[model samples]
Target chain A: MSEQAGYVPVVGAVAEPQPAPEKSYRFSEQAIQELEEILTHYPDKKSAILPALWIAQREYDGYLPPQAIQEVADRLERPFVEVEGVATFYTMYNLRKRGRHHLEVCTCLTCAVMGAYEVVHHLEKRLGVKVGQTTSDGEFTLSEVECLNYCGAATVVQVGDKYFGNITKENVDELIETLRNSNEFTPADLANAIVRLHIPERTAKK
Target chain B: MAETLVLLKHRDVPGIENIDIYEQHGGYAGLKKALAMERDAVINEIKTSGLRGRGGAGFPAWIKWSGIPKDTKKPHYVLCNADEGEPGTFKDRELMLKLPHMVIEGMIIAAYATQSAKGYIYIRGEFVESARSIRRAIDQAYKKGYLGKSICGKEGFDFDLYIHMGAGSYECGEESALMSSLMGERGQPRLKFPHAPLPIHEGVWQSPTLINNVETYAAASQILAHGGAWYATMGTENSKGTKIISVSGHVKKPGNYEVELGYPVLDMIELAGGVTGGKLKAVIPGGSSVPIIPAELCKDFKLDYDAHQVVQYSMRTMRLPVVGSGGFMVFNDKTDIVVLMRRTAEFYTHESCGKCTPCREGTRWIFKILSRITTGGGLPGDIDLLVNICDQIDGRSYCGLGDAAAWPIMGAIKHFRHEFEYWIEHKRSPVGEDCLPPAPEPLNPLLTLTPV
Candidate 1:
């Protein structure tokens, strides 16, 4: 069953009653192009709003500002509330300021067995921030999640889609150091070379 | 493209999830094929193919579809269960987002098989992108003569599909609750089994209806085109066709693993880099509602639906029977099994809907006591109290969710008494320290991407 493009006019895909604000996320043409490429996957551009929001959140320090939300809304031709609803629905998506770096500690089974409680407690003590709270220096936001699905590596964290697998308190300091000196690194360097990224989403290994 | 199963077969074919690419890949062939067949042949093929519901129950698809008698002569309706409220489950969302047309096409095929024209996609509210995609895809089908009016060039056959966003209730994942929500009612679990009164024979708007999971509908398209035997060959005996297992929790590589039905859970673990240092303690093979069996025990556990049932039903001496929600929640050695039970108990307590008192207030009492005990605020008799509370909630609610909610606490206490005692006595989870890695280095500022 082949679907023809531009068949039914989407309520927001083409135009909306009110316009959105101009984008000012310090996003480069290259990043915007990358996002544009992703949006092309759908017949209606509005379908890309979630991934667009994810990209925007990453660019804006884990939270999407009203303008950031509007930018994605406008890009997808969807109502601003529609985009906002999505940004707020997922616990993972941040719409407010977190830390300079986001550390999501998975406390599910494998890592829990490996003393993930210690990792969580240590991070809480070390960073002096409770889960969901950012460090005073704004360098880190420590959060506990149900599972990151990498129990094999237990004690995992995603500092922006990059998986740091099989973590421990000993490696916590090094991970923090890496974040502090992130200026010298590229994500290609830190994403647990073990688990590949969500590129093309769900491209699982055989 | 009208409809294409992109995520299911996207890698094998380009433009599979993409509208333009899907169109180029000869995507809507199934719909065209479906329209050409007499709806009876379509139904019979699904019947013979041995397609099972992708939803946890794994019921026979054709039998469920055929429940509605054609001779009754009532209006036929079709529903797509895209509510996808299962935790640790994002496969439906991913598939819908990637290939909206595929689901649309699948819905069309299922509608034809069940002899229903009007359909609704009841999607979870959290799936914003999926909703948008399905909505857009339906609009695309309508524009292309794929969704509305007549099918391809067929007569006396027309289909209409609508996407209704959910109100953020996990309980709505149940088909009956989903029906209630679609009818615009608050999603409170019904204690009584609303007898499967042949929905296809008589359903929504009081017509015969066929309701299928998004994946099942997609598979219907495949079976309609490739034939029953071809479709049956891909899966295991008793349970034919592949299954999309959402491997979450503690796996190194967490995501959807689409495999032939009989693949072992161990294979899925290795697929996830051998469970992050191989310290997997226990796993909730289905979902949190499913009992947490030791990971070591699950090594030989077959991922097939029937095999899992056998192992969990007969082998595992559970107090309550398992419900079929394919939510694989992994627990590592570091997890405070007892505390985890407390959290789950609390969720069931808070979400019980209270239609039945035994479940309504009973769940809450257990959760409160379990929480206090886990946090080191328990009285001496709390463990027995917790067990008693579980007993009260089990089989005492209006819906299976009550028993489903109580299973884990009762089972965990039965299996891991020491962990619970440790938490009660020490006021801490035996899970020790959380071993999660520290935050990674921020994106290089010079690299032009700022940290969020």
Candidate 2:
């Protein structure tokens, strides 16, 4: 069942071979400053791994390639395999490349009963791709997610940082069109929002 | 009874998320009251209120609050479990989004009572909007001196709160696993008491820590603000205070409703504009982890910790529903019990952290068997096999996730055995053509080519 429906890689999948560490670090100076400030929030640099990976996801543009994982390990002074283990254990951290917009429809129990599958089938038809595949233009990637926890708005479709709720097969096309023209809710933006949350406003303002 | 507005009282107020508006609406009054009292006095207030943990366990709040060592040599930490990943729950999401200050104020009060120097709100990563609201509130609190060193001019009372974002792991909602995730490890459960010391003694960084659900902390703030005795006036003898029920699924008015504990289950259904589409069928009174109650049994139940216990005693069965985390999900007559249980099984399978053998391997097997049955490959023994699998996984697992995965399936089979038998004998859903969760497509294309 997971072979077809599961879009995110199963957690704790064996780590792929790491790219050579010779590539220069890609994190900009501001990103470095943000990481340094985040370090102060926790006692050890190791606790900063989750936030560092979020920054890596942002810096690497959407998904964490091997180079991005290496950059995070190098920055935190941890083992590459150790960082990869943490990254792979989480479903939100995309291991492979994704389209500019990742459409995650909640197909958990409440959403399922409320016609979440119809929404999924509609998106597949509109995008001309199956559940886990990206559109031809690399604009949209469709996948069924576990409960986004907004079940009151069943059939909640998460587009990056934003959650479009009360969606159905009928209104999903309007949402897709809106997402097609907007770039604010990309995977990078999702990572950026999570990263900024860790840094206190007092520190961020300065 | 009607919806009682306590935590959500000022939820719809304009600019309530801001410090100024929140302060004007009697915000931080609880912190002021708590700061004036002795540390033990603050705990005494909570004890008076009889408030239990709203994070599903229903453990008494005062026991955990007073559990922290008074003369601890190590630094104490207060952690808020804001990762609301329960399938049918979104109350914490709304609380954090609308009443961020209330949650923060409660955390501050907890830090004061526990004498903790540091705290963290480990929110799930999908809740970026909620996290943003909390971020703004925390910044405002720091600016107003509600947080940081010498809070509100109290000497030797310094508290620092930080936001730790989880990367989409439901297992982190478990307390020990939450600490594991906070320290940047795999979000897996640790051995519990009798096997290991409780988290209050040796927790994150080997320090005494106090962890409470988002609703628990928010209720703490309210309990402190109004004296515990005043707060105790509502609810049943054992259960006190109002609980925010996240009503969804086949309900006409699906949203978060903060109703007092001991409210009738049937009344709650009506409160949410009654069930939509058809007659009421079943209700998962708690989150998906608890047992699913057939509509006939739901009438006598009340929304409280002890009421659920009464249900178990009357039925003479251990597998009964509870008011768990207040994720009230109502289903209509058109819903198919077998199909709903299949989706429920799939959720637990996807979320099992693989920390223990019983949960990791068992959840997969359960899903596999259910999928097979749903796809028209059910053996006559499949029903008993599913029960056997549930029994093995129930008490044997490391944490509650295994039990959570087993209970609903067990509950479904207990109440709707006929549905399972019909499916096995007829090779079709008993609900017929319009059944929800529509039948699963066969995993193999060739199987679809052949007729049932």
Candidate 3:
């Protein structure tokens, strides 16, 4: 699942119409610099795809939408359809639009064996929207993914940049509320607030 | 009564454990029926069965078999991925030990359907006893005309099966890596290039090979015996037939339990002696690669397909319904979510193969940050820094293995941020205040501290 970080193309078998390419959307200078720096860490050019998409998604509101994947494909020199296949294969690559905040629920074997199905159901029922479908308010989008790699502790999740392992429906609701109420929150603030409950240093910036 | 392979399917056949007993119970009837049918009919039968892989990825078994290019210039080969490396899962071992013949029979039918003259069972090294049993069963099958040429007394259909044991690495669970390992390589993933692309078309000496999980092969026997419709009616609409769940951890009876695909997790837990420890903390629904769900969130979860779609929660890994090897690992209040993560991180790092920079270095970086945080040596910005690194590692790696390493760390920090903070601020675990097990709650893998 999520624990093993090996390099691979988002390999998938998808037959989709290839849209014509357009001019690259100008990423904020900070976003470009940030993504470029991340790419420098990788030895290969294509290795920066997931990170590039992440930056691209965050910079252009939320979600890669098809064009973004294509743009990144062109930039990386990856084939258009092949890049699309990679974009769609993994859950982290968001094809559709999402809320301002994104939440990831782990449904890997450890979590599933530990009861992740109910976690997903509870979140969907609480959000009044099925996973992969954004909320009516666009505050959130529910997506069920495979393992975030916590076999020993099932029912783990990630909201924004913070990971909330050993979570329950009650905690999930609180997390959703915290995100719904707060905008421009740092990863530390949310992590400390919804996860550890009290951590000044980690949340010092906020 | 002794536990045996028959328990996997829960058949009432007498003497199912012994070879003679199994033969007497009409075990090889499917192979007999297979020999009597045309190759395409057998392939079409599997296609009609709606059988997905029993392994974690629910890929269609027949379509995979169909992709072998029967008329290719090269001979098509069959490979069984018996490498059960998923954490909190061990259903394949029991099946291999108990019903090796079932796998053999299924392989025979598949060989006939795909016209594969040679077959190999790639089992894990940890399964010593199971491998022995499987080897014995293969020998027995050979003597009885099921494995060798003129199998079941039919002419011109020669097929041979061999069991290849792995050196025990989780990455090898991946098909391309598994093929590489079977061919005596380092067991790392390969890239799919244009023109010379696709692992299936060229695996193990570059042959058009068909690879299936062990359990999927076993399903072939049932499809041959009872037909696809019978198999289809057993599970959910999209998910057909029963699955054997290797239930372990936090349950009284931690063993493999055969179940219909649509059963509830609660029912499955109850079958395994419900809640050995009080206040269920979390549950790993699939294998270690899938995310964990806390007990409260899992109140209504049913252990079936479509119910626990991982993509909803940002989980991208596939959870095969234990087709290759069924296994389920459960966690309770005593389990430390953080310490578990730290341990899991160590596994991925140790097995990283160091192929890609993001993954090779990322797994190490994640572990290092986690180690620093868990051992009270964490800097204030370490958590964010760790998340930031995992963020890059998530989709940047060559395969899903990189995501596997990054997602757990990401999920752990999200749910158990206090543990990391405490390790940094107080150099202690959060369980000190909570009413834990008799003494202290076991260390969470993410938050576990290295001894000073």
Best by DockQ: 2
Model 3 misplacement above 4 A: A1-206, B1-7, B10-17, B193-196, B307-326, B417-425, B433-452
B315-368 in candidate 3: lDDT tens per residue?
Answer: 344332222234566677766666566656765765665668899898878777
Better of 1 and 2 by TM-score: 2
lDDT of 2 by residue, B99-119 (tens): 999999999999999989999
In angstroms, how far off is A36's CA in candidate 1? Answer: 33
> Model 1 off-target regions past 4 Å?
A1-206, B1-7, B11-14, B71-74, B191-202, B308-323, B379-381, B435-452
Q: For model 1, how does the per-residue alpha-carbon lDDT over B44-65 read when each residue is reduced to its tens digit?
A: 8898789888876788998877
Candidates in order have lDDT scores of: 0.64, 0.88, 0.64
Candidate 1 TM-score, C-alpha based: 0.66
* lDDT: worst 10-residue window of model 3 chain B: B433-442
TM-score of each: 0.66, 0.94, 0.63
DockQ for the candidate 3 complex?
Answer: 0.03
Q: In model 2, how large is the Cα lDDT of residue A157?
A: 89
